[model samples]
Target chain A: MKQRLSTLMVAAVMTASFAAHAQQPAKKAPPPAKAAAPAKKEGITAEFEKFREVLEEDNPAELFEAKGEDIWKNKKGPGGATMAQCDLGLGAGVVKGAYVQMPRWFADVGQVMDAERRIVHCMVKYLGYKEEDIRKQPFSNDQRTPDHVSVITYVAAQSRNLKIAAPQKHAKEIEAYRIGKEIFAYRAGPYDFSCATCHGDDGKRIRTQDLPNLRKPAEAVKAYQGWPGYRMTGGFMLTQQWRMNDCFRQQRFPEPTYLSDSITALLAYMTVTANGQVYKGPGIKR
Target chain B: MADPMKIRAQMKGDTAEIRVLMSHAMETGQRKDNAGATVPAHFIQAITVDVGGKRVIQGQTSTSVSRNPVFGFKVKGAKVGDKVVIHWEDNKGDKRTDEAVIAA
Candidate 1:
């Protein structure tokens, strides 16, 4: 009888232990499956960054490349000549590998010319298009690229993968470079901000995007070379010249004239700083 | 025509892997211009993919899709030397069609 009672007691103890184990919910059986993916935020951020890198592999700037070629080949002015023979620092009829070396002193114009200004010179000298009308619009809208802007993207794309080597020769180029440094440091806008306010320090950021210090050569290459790019946010294809005008506007200063000395000088600073990097644009921009 | 879409289709064993970069704004129309003008609603509504003239994929999209949309997908039973074609139509009635051949 004692043995029978002891056996029954042992069975009771076993059942109680089993019930207690099931009640705690601390074991890895059922609850762990639900907690398998706990680090949701980190996983998502890593995934999004990977996705962006993959998306940038094929840039959409080629669309403007086609349009720019067509515009260059077609006649626009009463002079009835295409811009095929207009000089862009590398001599007439040379569109390839000329962009990375521009913002240089042009003996004909007697000033350094960026892509837009050089194209304007060609429009005037070869195509006989009025300079005033060309400057009337320096940016593109929803429908079409302004002639000069399209030409800039086209020329820049041709120079892609070539080293950026804008010359610092000529007394005028040296003077422009000096003035560009002054402008980058000058702080007299309503907000008392210059390009230095945000870009003076490396690793500084406005929001989620990191602002590349244009003063630093390594970062300047990353920032300056990829312009005339298609900006996804504004749904606009922007030129480097347009970007200069907008930067001043953001600081509440009078906007810089398109391809003006003020604008070109700042670009000269960036170009000189980025002397050896290869051009890899028109790049995709946020 | 606008620039042709950049596409790559590669055949691996029995499947075809394709990647495409399309030039489009995919504008949601919820934004405004610098002049405070209301940007109109314009976006791609549909995309279709075909293998050697046989339709393989048809996708629908909205403003949720980002601008300059990049897309990728896989197809079964593909071999080298087959042609892959892709086309997309936007709400504004603009369409672009481009094709690539599957390379081994």
Candidate 2:
């Protein structure tokens, strides 16, 4: 419980209205003096950055973290087992610093796994849940949220402040990384835009939201760290797995399968690109 | 299974600080899904806080509020070990109440 956290963590929804109010005024002003300005990205991007500063104080993700911590220890599923003993690649039941090492090798599945995929694996193997049932509702929607998402928020938060060091020792992990790199570059869909179109270049944005050039190390580090974040726009906690899927949606491509090998490969590519950077997340995002 | 709300209550001298995070769609009914179907509005209309079974703070909310909203308040004349209960009622009449104990 972060009850006394000195940092001013805002209640969700309250600040979004403020951000919306701040977004339009600058653009509506007489354009003569500001129109010729280079890039002209200052209006909404500046406002969002300021808004992010305020949200950064206390992320709503912490609420999920609290719920997740309880779920980790409580018995559930058909097997009546707690998720506490499931291995996160650092050995059984070890949570701290486990997330940063993931998208790494796991000998049991014999392939590299992302947090969602791994959690699903644990759910099946340890808790006796069906994979198809688990995959059916992986993302949170208007009606409800799968327990897995909060579990992930709990798992990912454990690595807060640790350096991202995704292992490439295994051939499978290396291959996953290579596949992820390629996925990051492969362009297609209605817009013919790859992740590169937005994330490949520096200082790119869709509207007011700033896009991080995940190709570069520092930006990758910063972007990669905060995922499984609370999104102000969507009003939900989104996992990195959800991040990959949403990106594909925005690209006008068909929906990407949750925790598919391709998505894991993309994560391998990103976390690896962000290697050696300090992770400070379970972050709040716009 | 019902959706859970997170509650934290910390006693600061004579006053107890309480914060709550509620998980709800808060769907505005105006938005559409990817399939273009209208998502009906579902949101918390009111929130009440009680300590030691006594009513204290009551507030109202609307659809304009964001999903999974967070709210915090300070209660006077509170002490450590006092039980803090938060009850919320949505427009659909769906209700959730969660409680926490104040820390000394």
Candidate 3:
């Protein structure tokens, strides 16, 4: 009886999906000559791409970058020290081309740190802002954006058009990459889903959104770059760290703590895999 | 105090192309917040563009505009090195003005 019921359920699901497809507007139906092509999906993707192209010309992310530049140069926090002197891997006060080489081993912290982590560290060290206070509301919401996100946006924009060259020189950097690779494939949580489940292969998508294959260099660059994007839906500026946390939530896994090492590891792996691609600065997202 | 706008003016042939990106909440007043309170309406109401100290474009906007809205204008008789100033006033009485020079 149970076997028969399971079969019946499967049949119902198939019928429901067929009905959903049938309900699509007649205007969206492909002509008979293009029956063999995935015309419907391609059309939607193309439309989205066109929309993105139009919005990309005047991205709102630039506004955040400007705000960040102001914050970086101005004195604030308890220490009242400007972040202008903050060292972002290359040396103190160097802003250009520092973003593309992030998730590197920072000897001062003795850990592999990504761009967001390094920015927060500078905020703490130079600006005297408490780490916990900053972590309390790290992600942007509809109403407000955290200062660090804007700072990262500014930093990332400085590296615009630079090639991604996430260093794997140090032992710790290599270890972070390895751990990131593992985390990408490790499956857990109620959904039994991993990042690789959705992104490990090409031509994968969730609903209408195409998922880039993280394992392939070409596709990995697509996934890695254009982050720290300005999300049009919410008009909020978000960083890759927020993206990674949201991914975990979608998989029904426990969200990692803000500025955690594991999140840095994941970023290291993705950035390293996407090495050599020119980052197009901060991007606009649908 | 309101944040400043980003203005870019460039010479496109004889006409000067002016693009402005303004930052605002642009709340429609129809939407509710996470705590179920109605968010107040706040949006840019009037916009004016001055080219070489002459008013070239004056317009009004409403809640329909998106947050951090971008506006573009084209003005004749403006040359490179001409000053383009954009000023906007919101419904809440907040205002911001920013200027840029037309570039070749």
Top TM-score prediction, candidate number: 3
DockQ of each: 0.16, 0.19, 0.10
DockQ, 0 to 1 scale, candidate 3:
0.10
- As for TM-score, the candidate ahead, 1 or 2, is 1
> Best-fitting candidate, measured by lDDT?
3
TM-score of chain A of 2: 0.84
Per-residue error at A6 for model 3, in Å?
75
Candidate 2, residues A220-275: lDDT per residue as tens digits? 98778668888776767778888888899999988877778899999999999999
The candidates, ranked best first by TM-score, are 3, 1, 2
Cα distance off (Å), candidate 1, residue B100: 2.5
Q: Give candidate 3's error at residue A272 in angstroms.
A: 0.2
TM-score of each: 0.78, 0.77, 0.88
Model 2 per-residue lDDT tens digits across residues B1-104: 34677777887766677767777777788998888999888878988878756677677888877777766667776678878888999988899989999887
- In candidate 2, stretches whose alpha carbon ends up further than 4 angstroms from where it belongs are A1-41, A187-192, A252-255, B1-4, B7-19, B27-42, B49-56, B73-86, B91-104
Show the lowest summed lDDT stretch of 10 residues, model 2 chain A: A5-14
Model 1, runs deviating above 4 Å:
A1-51, A74-79, A127-130, B1-3, B11-15, B24-43, B90-94
